[model samples]
Target: MNLLDYVLPCLWAFLACVGFGLVFNIQGVGVLICGLGAGLGWLVYLVCVNFLTGDIFSAFVAAMAIGVYSEIMARIRRCPVTGYLQVALLPLVPGAGIYYTMRYCVEGETQLFLSTLLHTFGFAAALSIGAMLTSSVLRALLPKLRLGRE
Candidate 1:
């Protein structure tokens, strides 16, 4: 396991998320924070994938990390979680999976289409489920995490 395999990809993920944030007009410190969060989340995903060797598990962990970090950043910065979460999750979104699934379908490869479609949907469901779990836990704890405390 070479270091570049992980570090380089994580750096790319961070930059990609930052670019997406800028394109979407996320202002102030959020742009930087969102980018950092994406890198950290990607690191978690890569490490998980390296050890566990499963896409679904890695994506779930990465999505959960993004959700939790976004929630905390939102509380601290008084910004909406969606602003960071959406962009920070850019690394984990299964865009290529969906693209390939559709391509396979269009190419009349039924087996490949079904397999790719299921994998794509599985990844999406994993991310969604992780985010939902994080939101539920965070919502229950948010009141206790009041800002401006001494």
Candidate 2:
């Protein structure tokens, strides 16, 4: 991919993070925090896709990492995880995949439509599962960290 591809994705992720922060009523610096989280997550996704030769799996892992990191940061800062996780997860939403699937369906291409729909749903499911699993692990580990007192 070219610079435009990288920059556009990061820009979209940042915008999504800003919207999420606004909707959630996050406090000062939360918007920046969320945007940075999203940018970092997208960077990881881009690096994995470009260098690791992995496909959606790399994206899934990147999303999970973002969720975990966001949770840790939220705990440290005593803020809501929603702001960070929602922004970080913007890159993994499969927006284009779902849009193409819906477009194919509208064109009456049944097989192609179904295939794309399945791919989109599978990608989305993987993202949700990965995020949930990471959150669970973080929850389990947080109690042992003794960071809550800070």
Top of the candidates by lDDT: 1
In order, candidate lDDTs are 0.87, 0.80
Each candidate structure's TM-score, on Cα atoms with residue i matched to residue i, is 0.92, 0.85
Clashes of 2: 0
Clashing pairs in 2: none
Candidate 2 RMSD to the correct structure = 2.3
- Model 1 alpha-carbon miss at residue 119, Å: 0.7
Off by over 4 Å in 2: 1-8
TM-score of 2: 0.85
Q: C-alpha displacement of 15 in model 2, angstroms?
A: 3.5
